[model samples]
Target: MADMQIDSSPVRTVNVTRYVTPLREGGSLPAIAEADDGFLYVLKFRGAGQGVKALIADLLGGELARALGLKVPEIVFANLDTAFGRTEPDEEIQDLLKASVGQNLALHYLSGSITYDPAVTVIEPKLASQIVWLDCLLTNVDRTARNTNMLVWNKELWLIDHGASLYFHHSWDNWAEQSLRPFVQVKDHVLLPQAAELDEVDAAYRAMLTEEKVRSIVELIPDEWLTASASDAIAADRREVYARFLTARIASSEIFVKEAQHARKSLI
Candidate 1:
């Protein structure tokens, strides 16, 4: 595992107002608030017993994708300190505290009943290709053909939800080999025409997202979500897979088009 170079510095502080709203999904809680500087934010509270692992997954996944030169939403860790003096003190909350920014307003109020469909949100085949490529690199099995956890805002796709990855980390050594294997075939597919313009991804982004970064991110996950040794093993395995996928995508000239082709076929 390589050393991760993420700047664990605080970016900004935000005030969150806790007025919970309902989503169509029915389980998650959304809050509306404004940052100190007046920017709107949407804060989605993790469900009971889910802990802060979901938040960690979102933050780490978003950060890694951003480093890989993908167009993800501007996401940062947020702390939910209640007006009544209640504080989230679990490991998950503690990890979020390290990168806490401001609170967020629930997106449902801003976007209004936007269906979580890949075809509708990722309308372009080229963009879809990049998303699929990114997901494969991250080992995010949750973003399947049917349930695309994304938001289409200002004509762009914003990915969300990544707590399900690194599932194999619960137990195993040399997990990198398994993680890096799926990407051996990425070169065979076409990514996007625009990918040609993105010839070089920023080195700082790559350096910040080494295996160490993945481990640190994993450490923030609640122990309840993952037991001791098995969780560590799963995290290692997934990180290795992610690193290999990133290397292949960045270094290769080939594009991944299988998902895009399938998407197109479905449209016809």
Candidate 2:
């Protein structure tokens, strides 16, 4: 991002102690695992189909959501031991673990959380607007009602599963033209009906997400995850591009905010 020094207090390293169970909802196949710190974490493997870029998005996205005062599980650096793979009896999981025996990402497990249900849950309009605003700013396309990727732990909503964001990076050729693209998926956002202060939420978050704050989140991405070829000028500064995109989106949030607001009206 910028040349400013980023604080590293958010990055914590933990050793993977045991593989618990597989969460097969998405293609990534992330699993629940116990770590050396005596806490269970939902480990996101680097070798999964989405590869390193997904991990990068997960880290940065979670941090950005937290910055906007949203509740997010703690993310940590998971150090996988090569031998851990040999203990697995399942061939597919064994291969996956063997391939991911190094620094990976993990989200602290919420011991007893329920998936969000709009039919029963009563979300504050402000919180819903903030959530819709954050998802739009990040261009996250995975927050629809069918796949909310949100959890209700201790009777509070918590954000999770941010890897689906920054999908623009998948095909870099015409990325620039699509950088300022509108988020059409807001129409299906699960919390749209509960959102009543899109403009206020947008303004507050825009003011809060300064260059340094965005850069700090970008900096949390491990260097190895920024693996795109440095030969391309844009690829060389992959971190910078991510931060710039977020800052740009924040500056240009009016269109998306209006879209969200319009979607809210359409519900009436």
> Who wins the TM-score comparison?
2
Give each model a TM-score. Answer: 0.52, 0.92
Instruction: Point out where model 1 deviates above 4 Å.
Output: 1-11, 24-37, 46-49, 82-113, 116-122, 169-174, 181-268
Which one is best on lDDT?
2
Per-residue lDDT of 207 in model 1: 54
Per-residue alpha-carbon lDDT of candidate 2 for residues 89-154, written as tens digits (9 for 90 to 100): 899999899889889999888888999988888899999999999988878889888898999988
lDDT score at residue 203, model 2, on the 0-100 scale: 81
* Clash-forming residue pairs, model 2: none
- Give candidate 1's TM-score: 0.52
- Count of residue pairs whose backbone atoms collide, per candidate: 22, 0
Could you give candidate 1's per-residue lDDT for residues 74-162 as a string of tens digits? 55444445441134444543343333333321222234325445334435544545555565455566664455566655565566555
What's the lDDT for candidate 1? 0.44
